[model samples]
Target: MPVKLAQSSFRDRTQEFQSVAERLRKSFSSGPGQNGPSSNTSRAEEQRSVVAHQSEFNRRASKIGFGIHQTSQKLSNGQENFSF
Candidate 1:
């Protein structure tokens, strides 16, 4: 059997995946190998900022691969609806 979900629910799940990726990136940046916990860590901060930038890039890339990037649409009633 195949798993299925409502469109909105799927959107929520994708958002969760992005959140997890973000958290993992943060954890990776803060780990012992990346930088020390003391002193000015400007380079580490720059790398962290890069990761933050790439995270959205990765998320949109995945969303496009998963065919879920069109989850946002305007309804006839002038409200937003996500359905496919």
Candidate 2:
């Protein structure tokens, strides 16, 4: 029989975080009454930067989850040689 393992919560948590980050970015970019064009542009850029970093974080989290799943599969299949 194939080994079964519970999925990790890291991806779920990361997705939640990404949602929050997106909201924040939208709020920041849409704020009203900025003093000048430069200020408004800078704030928009900052929001983009934040969202970009969050996306990178989510990608890394997904990769980690994939690795964990692979390891679990190997252990279940009795293919892993090392003991934990």
Candidate 3:
């Protein structure tokens, strides 16, 4: 791990290592978002999010389409059916 290396790298000078270690510790622990193994967005997760969004969009669009079909049917009620 980089943290171990950072801590061990300063083994020769205890005082300097202590101060750098404190800084490194703060840097590592400062934020929940950036403290993970890989701070960047994972490709698989991004793909999953995109798929989720598209699925939601399709669901909403289908609902709207059904509503439109129902409205058109009601509007055409009792009217002569014309083949177009």
Candidate 4:
């Protein structure tokens, strides 16, 4: 996928994840102590965690295009190897 497209999708996912996380946090904070998280809260936390992972993936993907461009330039200049 294009970097911009991937970034946009990642941002959307992150927003959704953050929304859910916020809801869960609010619920937990409003509840009494000593009880475990509710099922929805647990699921929300899981989903939000995945968003963190996806954000990292998006960051790596963002660098890929720049890396490829630099590598191509190096190869054309005989400054880097193109063969395995």
- Per residue, candidate 4 scores C-alpha lDDT tens digits across 1-84 of 656544443234888889999989987786544355576677778999999999999999989988999988887888444455
Candidate 1 vs candidate 4: the TM-score winner is: 4
Q: Could you tell which candidate, 1 or 3, scores higher by TM-score?
A: 3
Worst 10 residues of 2 by lDDT: 27-36
| Model 4 TM-score on a 0 to 1 scale | 0.40
Q: What local distance difference test score does each model get?
A: 0.69, 0.85, 0.79, 0.78
Most accurate candidate by TM-score? 2
Candidate 2 on 1-84: residue-level lDDT in tens? Answer: 998998876544888889999988876787555457887788789999999999999999999999999999988889566578
Candidate 4 Cα misplacement greater than 4 A, ranges? 1-37, 77-84
Put down candidate 1 lDDT per residue, 1-84, tens digits, no spaces: 998965663234888889999988987777455555542376678889999999989998997866643443223434535455
For each of the candidates, the C-alpha root-mean-square deviation to the true structure, in angstroms, is: 23.2, 23.3, 15.3, 20.3
Candidate 1 overall lDDT versus native: 0.69
TM-score of 3: 0.45
What TM-score quantifies how close candidate 1 is to the native fold?
A: 0.32
Better of 2 and 4 by lDDT: 2
- Of models 2 and 4, which has the larger TM-score? 2
Tell me the number of clashing residue pairs for each predicted model: 0, 0, 0, 0
In angstroms, what RMSD does candidate 4 have relative to the true structure?
20.3
